[model samples]
Target: MEEKSGSLVEWLAPLAFILCAGWLTWHLPAFTLSWFPPKDPSQYDKLSALFARIDVTDSMTGLFGGYADAVDWAALLLLPVFGIIGVRTVRRAPMEFESWKPLDRLAVFIGRLTMMLIVLLCSVMIYEVILRYVFEAPTLWANELSLWLAGFVFLCAGLYAMQQRSHIRIFLLYDMMPRWLQRVCDIISTTLIVTFAFFLVYGGYGEAFDKFYRWETFGTVFDPPIPATLKPMVLLVMVLVAFQAIVNLISDWNAEPVIHTAADDIDQDELDRLRAAVGADGTGDLDVTRGSIQSNTPGKS
Candidate 1:
């Protein structure tokens, strides 16, 4: 039991790290959700005064700070949510798969990759802080470095998320259907996801290829290649995601619905003991009394 619980933790820790990294990304200004006021001008105080007055109508113009213009920061919030949710999905135990073996190995590998990206991102910021503030010399490559990391995380994690059953699904209608119909719906949905992913891969490859051909750069001191180096990853991961979706569909098709028993929602120890008494291992591999465990919810066992 200790070994089993430790195994579960091993699967969960990397996911938890990714979730924290995502939360930080969401709240941090580096991601651009936070704002910084610009250099002050004579109009700045006047604009500030106007902003203070409730009767003013040009709040939009007045809100424009710094040398340029103001923009909405709401979209930045989605980045973190996507990251966290993707990691969470990857971290979850595959109650859907009975024996850990190869399936569990794949999930763990994906989790580790996600965690590595998160750590690398954090390391960059730490380096930025030490060099920019401590050494009093800022690196122009910081922004480019961060963006590159973000792109990799986003693309690679999408595949991992799909494998973990963490992607969004509208199952309200399917949940109400009969078992056979539910399987049918699963088939249809799986087919559509594969089709969409295939097209995305095809289109994204062309787009990325063009960008690479253009020799695009960030136009900064570092002059890092923009959308050129990362383009292939975009197409690659999409293809990987499509492949994973295919595997998922095949797995689901072969898998029987979970079987629930008197110990269905009970504690693991109690469930184990009960199963032992019933001459079953509760591992979903043996048929002691009945042929199989009744399907209740996925990934619970």
Candidate 2:
């Protein structure tokens, strides 16, 4: 029987980890810097801009009027999370990957985040549609939020694509090369990826840092700091992608040579689904009894 990986429970740990990190990412820095609050009392940091300031410091339920309690709890919670789930999900999917190094896990985890963010982007657009059509009062933030999520989604998807080895490659002659030359081609490709990452990060570091420090915004009514977040995120994800490329090179060093043909692009699983959809065996016209039974079932027509 073929298995599917569409279960939500399998994603519980990654979701928890992202949530805990987000909550703490906001609360910790805000509280720690409260003693000598921002040089400008009215200014908002990038995190504060999105969430507004929650003043966890003075809330009775927020614990000791601050984030120490929250941070400590998060630490305790996350330690066991990654440890228990460790390198991968508890219930591995049929196609969920067998070897998950730390970098591989990070890539997969970010890929999942991209999926959730895509859902969030769709939700934001739907909300905008409803407001504009039904309520006649569209939100300023919705479109910008979608753009921001989309930027990160694209970056994360690139990282995921690299890890999955699904990126485009022209292998017309490369496929015919000897195994040693193939490994040579892999090394050259990996080096080129590393070179690209290095130049990108080095050249963009100053600008990304400056924008993050200044909390640069889009200057609209919503005024999201897309510049601040996306700039740094690009560099960070680029580094992760470069490292993942190296990891892939190392992992696949001994992998068997891959041969490409027009038939190779055909998806067996999809064909199986299509076969099931049409109630056909592998030899589509051979199973007469099977077809007759399915045809007789009340809804087959």
Tell me, by lDDT, which candidate is best.
Answer: 2
- TM-score of decoy 2: 0.74
lDDT of 1 at 96: 36
Q: Lowest-scoring 10 consecutive residues by lDDT in candidate 2? A: 285-294
Candidate 2, position 179, lDDT:
91
Show model 1 residue runs off by greater than 4 Å. 1-108, 213-215, 258-301
Q: What is candidate 1's lDDT per residue for 160-276, written digit by digit as tens?
A: 677766677655566567778877877887788779878887778777865554434566676555466577667777666766766777767756664444554576666665565
Worst 10 residues of 1 by lDDT: 25-34
Q: Write the residue-wise lDDT of candidate 2 on 91-200 in tens digits.
A: 33465555467788778777776777787789889999999999999888898878887998899899988988888989998999999999999999999999999999
